[model samples]
Target chain A: MAMIETFGLTKRFGSLTAVDDLTTRIDGEIFGLLGPNGSGKTTTVKMLTTLLTPTAGDAHICGYSVREHPRDVREHISYVPQDMAVDPKLTGRENVVFFGKLYGIPRPRDAAEEALARMGLLERADDLVRTYSGGMRRRLELAQALVHDPSVLFLDEPTIGLDVAGRRKIWEHIIGLKERGMTVFVTTHYMDEADHACDRVGIIDRGKVIVTETPGMLKASVCRDIVLIRSDDRFKGTFPEGVTFLGRTGNELRFEVEDGDEAVLVLSRLFAENGMDIRSVSVRKPTLDDVFLSLVGEQDEQTAFDLTRFRTMLRRR
Target chain B: MIRTLWYVERDLRRWLRGRINLLSALIMPAAWLIFVGMALPIRFTDNYLDFITPGILVLTMLGAALQGGSLLMFDKILGFLQKFLAMPSPRESILYGKILFITLRGMIQTTVILVFAIILGAQFLDPVLLAQIYLILFIFGILLSSITTTVALTLEDHDTYAAFNAMIAMPLFFTSSALMPYDQMPSWLAVLARLNPVSYAIDAIRDLQAGIFPAMTLAGLLIGAFVVLLISVIIFRRATV
Candidate 1:
């Protein structure tokens, strides 16, 4: 049986449908719900974690329904929110042990130490979290969530607002969790991270799931190869059998071909034969970003006001 | 029950670390005890400190209990509420934990003021009577903190919650029989004081100190606290993060 399943799950805030007809099944694998802001990613996580009640339908974790058996569902899952959750006034060890106690762990102190060590926060475990850096604090949050050894871990934008190194470190820990046979559910808008990190991804847009596929399959479905040529002149004739013209923007010419390497050779010779001076030529494999844009169109950067996020930003100062 | 205590331990642990928060919480009540209780010379009483000590103790609990709302407010504002609500423990644990912690902290702060009041020439009551005073203060703390924590659950931001604290804390204190006897006040002011929950507690403690058992007042305060707590619990169980 799948570890996580949602049956037509829906949540509405007044007239706004935050999550609409979101139905999917996730087995014990690293699953990514990829979407832009306000695309219902967080709302879905909240509902599945038993934080917010669904307006319609229901979800199950480890075969326990979130609506009917929320306590059992909560017992099998742990959630790390997008915001920083560590208590700055308490020591790192205290924060983890606090969660351990809440989970009713038999040995909270030992469990806290083990979780802290796994997150590489053991050395600083005695220091107050207020003294830790942003990255260290994020790691501490992970330790706190993992103290109970939950089977399915839900991370809502776990690496948001972190440096490149910090982001990579968090992903490494996440990958380690999957290796240990834990089903990990994560959400993010960084397409490149999802492309390489997630075993399967579901692209959600406007509170609906647009498509669910492996990253490779999603990219392959969009286009196998994209060939681009930066030229001083446009090709007057394109009598190619396999290559199809994509579009032209300024002095750049774009095309889709069955094979990138073969297209690179053929397109270069074709440009020379056409008497077009090619400034640059390159063959690129389609990325998840490309697939997302093709499926969901452009995303508007401006999102509605999130009061909790705003208050979090204010308190950080 | 243990899970609830864990929640209380979390807040208590944090509250203990912030020495400034601890010191600042006592400063206002201490000022009131010293400036108004000691310096004020009223013709109605020879020792105003004895009369005002019960009032100051309740005021101390009032301040601490009202400020208790901010404990939950900070957790909500700082994103801890999401982590906490998603836990396996019952949701009432969080609400009960905050109320318990606020009440416990109030007891500690009022203990300090009681000792200080005695040192400043206020006649100390018998041990049994002092214990009764603590009981009245405990009941009052529970009643006020439950309401404030529930209010915190409904408010969206900390500023609005702070505004609420300022708006209610002072009026609740002044309109009660904290500063003067109800008989000394005008007719309208006496009526409001008689109706205020704060006055029920203060009057009970004062009656206890005066060798009169205010059985009816004590029973009324207990029932009021239990009813308010029941309503707060019902509201809290329905609350979502």
Candidate 2:
């Protein structure tokens, strides 16, 4: 059974459509909503979590409609937003216990303790959250979300600004949740995170899901073998078979080929015969970044996929 | 109900931990009671402290309620409001919890101010009258906090929220019957005071201190609090995340 599902879920802020006609189903697996900073990932998560009402359409979590039965939907789900929600003045234990009480757990303290232990925060559980580092605070947020043992967990940009080690720790914990049979719905700008952790990824652009598939399938479907050639002069004429010129950047020319090995040999021979001085030649497989670039087009230097830039663009619009 | 209490408990614990906030709450009201009460020589009663103590108490309530509402604004900015909104509890529980915490803070500040008044040689009222006065303060706190909550939720940022609160607090305090008797004010000011909920609360507290039951004033404050609370809940429900 699908643990979460949305049909034509739309949310508009003034004249801007933050989420437009989002239709998808997230079964009992780790489903990732991969998008750039302003691609409406957070807006969609907000609508799913019942923090924001949709302008149109519907969503369901654990068999409860988000619009008609928000309380029930909330009961079955937990959300960890990009910002840390735990109070800085309160201790980790207090934060989890408070969340437990909010969920009406019968034994809030025990539940809090168990959650803290799960997150490996049992030792510093009595310390104020202000004393915690960024990673520990993120863990505390995850612990608070898990105190109720929710069926569906939503994490929005869970490792957005964390260090490499910090992100890895969070990813381990998220994978652990999946092992415990919790359906995880995560949104992130880190393509590598989604590629490695997500069971399936939906690439959202301009408030729409442009593609939904496993990471491998998405890479395979969108991109072919890329042949990169660096030369001093531009190649005006191309006579190589099975090689199609793609585009150029600086002094490098790129081409898509059926087979990288054959293309590389043919291109090297052709370049030598044509007296072209090749600086470098290499064949590489397409990554998620390549797929994203192809789908969303290239972003300007100032409009890169960073939260601050995204917020600035949002404010301007 | 339990979830509401949980939120109230968390807020109270946080407020108590911030000793500066507690100290400031007491210091502001005490300063007004001592400085303002003594500087103004209106002899409505034997001791000026007795006369202004109730008014200062309302002022304290106003400040506490505004601060309480600003906490909500902070939660909204910091994204904790989204966490609470996604919880299983009813949305009203969040509003009620904050209001309850604000009322408790107001009651504490009022108690501290009352103690300071006694230190300044103001006589104490009867226990029953004291209870009645606290009840009136509680109701007044609820009304003001509800208004603050609505305004805070409506405004977008802390600066705007702070400016709006500061702009309104002084007028609400000075225009009410807190510092002077309503009859002693100019006729136009008296008319405004009659319509001010703070005036009704302060008048009830003053009457209780003078051993007179303020039935009409208490009724007005209770009704006003209920109506404002209902409006606040409605606004909170419609509040965008």
Candidate 3:
């Protein structure tokens, strides 16, 4: 049976459709919902974690319906929110024990200690969380979530603000959990993290899943190489059949081709025949960013400004 | 019920760790009992200490209850409320836990003020009367904390909640029978005191101290607490993070 399944899950915030018809399944693997800001990644996680009731359709975690049997679903899953969730006043051990008791674990103390040890926080478990570093607090949140030994875990931007090392350490624990046969559902805007950590990824945009596949498969399905050409003019002439025009901004044009070297040569000849001066040209292998851009389109200028303004308003609030 | 207790336990653990908060909570009420009770020189009562002790006790509980709302505010601000709501426990547990913690904390703080008043030469009552006094304070705690916690939940931020607290805390205490009896006040103030819930508990405690049961007033306070708590639970269950 699938560990997590959603059947046309939808959530509407008044006129805004935050998550629309989100249908997917994960079975004992780290599945990532990758999207840009306002793409409904966090909203989808919220619905599956039973935090927000879906306006239409339903989701099931471990065969328990989120709409009908929310408590059963809650019992099977744990969530780590994007914001800091640890109680700064309590010690690390106390935080874990508190979550354990909330989950009605029989031996909360033993379970809390073990979970703390697994997160490498046992040595400093007695220290107040306020005294711990940012990385330690994130790890402590993981320990608290694991105290119940849930079958599925949902992490929403788990390492959002962490430094490079902190992010790497969190991924290590996440991968470790996956190896032990736990189904992990994660949502992140960091394409690199999704490419490196996710066993399978679903690229969501504007509350819809664009594609779901393994990272390698997704890369292979998209163009292999991307050629970026900076020209002196916005040339109007179309060149050849093998080159696919991805996008254009100002004097720079982006294209997708099967082979980088061959495409560069073809493009140089075409540019000379068209009388357009090429300032510079570069060829690089396609990463997930290229796949995401091709699938979701470049973020329009107005939408990008609105996203920043929205984030600023949230921070002020 | 167990889940509710766990919520209470979590709040209690955090409360106990803040030693400065614990000590500071008693300071203002103690000052009222000592300075205002002794130095006011009011002609209505020969022993002002005995007369104002109940007021001080109720005031102490009032302060605790009002500040208790901030516990939920902090949880909301710090993102713990989101985590707690996502847990397996019923949402009512969070409400009950907060109400229980605020009431319990109020009871503890009132106990200290009661002891301090007695040590400073306020008249002492029998064990039965004392138990009734605690009972009245407990009901009052539930009433005020329910209102404050609900208000806290609806407000957008801590600063707004803090402003709301400041606007109500002093007015509720001063306009009630806490500082002076209703008869000693002007006609308008007397009318407001008669209608204030804070005065209901204080008057009942005074009646109990005077060897009367005050059955009607106690029943009224009980009904008020129950109704307010019911409303709070409804609001809480419908609350979304």
DockQ for candidate 1, please give it. Answer: 0.50
Please give the CA lDDT of all the candidate structures: 0.88, 0.86, 0.87
DockQ values, each candidate: 0.50, 0.48, 0.46
Give the alpha carbon lDDT tens digit for every residue of B32-85 in model 1.
899999888798898899999889999899989888877887787678888988
TM-score of each: 0.92, 0.88, 0.88
Question: What alpha-carbon RMSD in Å does predicted model 1 have with respect to the real structure?
Answer: 3.8
What CAPRI class is candidate 3? acceptable
For residues A1-317, could you state the per-residue lDDT of candidate 2 as single tens digits?
Answer: 58998999998776668789999998878999987767899889888998878999999899899999988999999999888777888999999999998899899899999999999999999999999988999999999999999999999999978999999999999999999999999998898888899999998888999988988888888778989999987566655667889888998988899778888889888888888899999999888888888888876557445666445333322
Candidate 1 residue spans exceeding 4 A from truth: A229-255, A261-279, A299-317
Interface RMSD of 3: 3.8
lDDT of 1 by residue, A58-79 (tens): 9989999999999999898999
**What's the CA error at residue A281 for candidate 3, in Å?**
13
Instruction: Please list the residue runs of candidate 3 whose C-alpha ends up more than 4 Å from where it truly belongs after superposition.
Output: A226-283, A300-317
Pairs of residues at least 3 apart in sequence or in different chains that clash in candidate 2? none
Model 2's DockQ score: 0.48
Local lDDT at B236 for model 1: 70
* Clashing pairs in model 1, backbone N/Cα/C closer than 3 A: none
How do the residues B138-183 of candidate 3 rate in per-residue lDDT, one tens digit apiece?
Answer: 8888888998999898776888989999998889888999888877
- TM-score, chain A, per candidate? 0.86, 0.80, 0.79
